[model samples]
Target: MEASGYLLSGVLTGLFLLGTVLVLARNRNWQHYSPAGDASGVGETVERLAGSPGTWIGGFVLLTLGLGLGTLVVVGGLPVPEGVQGAATVAMAVVVLAVLAGYVFLGVYHSVRYRGLYRSQAAAAGIWIVATLAVAGIAVMLLTAG
Candidate 1:
């Protein structure tokens, strides 16, 4: 149980870090077409990345992390740290919600900004945001009861 909790924590951390990097990559045109400024082939490039298998794979990874974390918390019977119930639970929920919201905003903005590469990439990001929120909600519930 402890190992699972540790694994889940690591997964969550990695997902957060990866999401951050993906946002930056889109913003900086790092994930855009190679030969950066070439507007001609940009559409094709964007389309490929947006619908790439990699995006789906990454989304699944995030979803798994969220589910895994929630499961670990339940199975391990971990209690919320003292004084972290009620409003504190609400506070943690808010923080996690904010993170998920930020991810969504980033995904939408990036999709619109780079319409060419919008589909796959944006879907992948969106999935992570949704998964994160779901897991965060469960985490808060578990913590609140403890």
Candidate 2:
């Protein structure tokens, strides 16, 4: 059972990484599709708010750290005091929930920003939702596994 848990965590981590790459690619594509001079209204607003690729890269790094720590805990590689384990579990849960919420927000933003060209954004959002759920499930398993 413990081995299986580790395997699941590994799979979820891979999925998360893949989803992150897809999102970054999509963001780049959006920038190219609607260059500065071409964008108007919502597209322009989104382009400005999205900032540069560096912003997304920084966000990805932070996300990787959060998820990596949670994965380590889930796989029983991290030791925690009994009392503190619960707090760690809560923290992981919050992290996963925040990621899920961020994906949902991106979906909405893309829907508005891309308007007629939202299929890719929708697909990326769906992938991210699944990845976030997998991470959440892994966190729950880790918290309850003892």
Candidate 3:
């Protein structure tokens, strides 16, 4: 209670509330899926966003760089005096990077193998996930830094 503070808890709670709102909005607004469940405006929007160059660039930045750095910040502690705390931080970093890399690879492969298009939508879904997580992660880190 004395060492950490309420910043982390507040950030987490805010993120959870935001997620809940998003889910609710999705269910309420985008509930017009066709009988097949695939034919919907959401699909078109996804395809469009995926095809956009911003998606690839942003995805790369967010998933690869953002998550990579964010994970280090977290595992290394909020304000890591140095690069890592101990072997544990290094090991945790390795695990996280590996998972992040694998996730990126899978998302890119899926986007290419399935969602075929002209432009490069490397990690469409992963980008969205990364963006959402990074925002919250950044918020928390910023609070901790303060």
Candidate 4:
């Protein structure tokens, strides 16, 4: 029964997105598209960020610290203090969301500041944000079910 509810929710969300995409297509909202073009500047954005020092190094350092702490908690059974035991999980979630937002913004932020992009980039980003929000909402519902 629980799984069925999730499936139903997923199906409804899928249908909604399909309808949205169809409407957007009919309206020609998916513009500025280049199947094989090098004008989006997104590649340069990524390359610019990657070429800087400490980009990969900082990420790996954080990952290593998180893994080490997680291992200590699970394997070593380290005792958490009275309060804020769940702070780590909440902080991790925030970090994940921040990273996701930054990545998504990267794919669309050039519309206002650079060429080869327009409303289409922003529209695509909007669609993705909506879909992700819907999925996250359903997941939260399932996880919080008592």
**What's the TM for model 4?**
0.46
Q: Give the TM-score of candidate 2.
A: 0.41
| Model 1 score (lDDT) | 0.66
Per-residue lDDT of candidate 3, residues 1-146 (tens digit): 64355666766787898898688757744333235676558988998998999988987776566556656675654677654546446765666766776676677657765766323344545565566666667776876785
Better of 1 and 4 by lDDT: 4
After superposing candidate 2 on the true structure, give the runs of residues whose Cα lies further than 4 Å from its correct spot.
1-50, 113-146
Each prediction's Cα lDDT score? 0.66, 0.73, 0.65, 0.69
lDDT-wise, the better of 2 and 3 is 2
| Better candidate number, 2 or 4, judged by lDDT | 2
RMSD of 4: 8.3
User: What are the per-residue Cα lDDT tens digits for candidate 2 across 1-146?
Assistant: 97788778778888898898878777753443553564457876777768878778988899899778876776677886665666667888888777777777667657655775566566666566666677678777976787
Query: How much is the lDDT of residue 35 in candidate 3?
Result: 55
Using all chains and alpha carbons, the TM-scores for the candidates as numbered come to: 0.28, 0.41, 0.30, 0.46
Q: Model 3 — TM-score against the truth?
A: 0.30
Worst 10 residues of 3 by lDDT: 117-126
| lDDT string, candidate 1, 17-128, tens digits | 8899778877864445435565698888888987999987997688667555554454444576544334445554565676667667676757654876555566676666
Better TM-score candidate (2, 3) = 2
TM-score of 1: 0.28
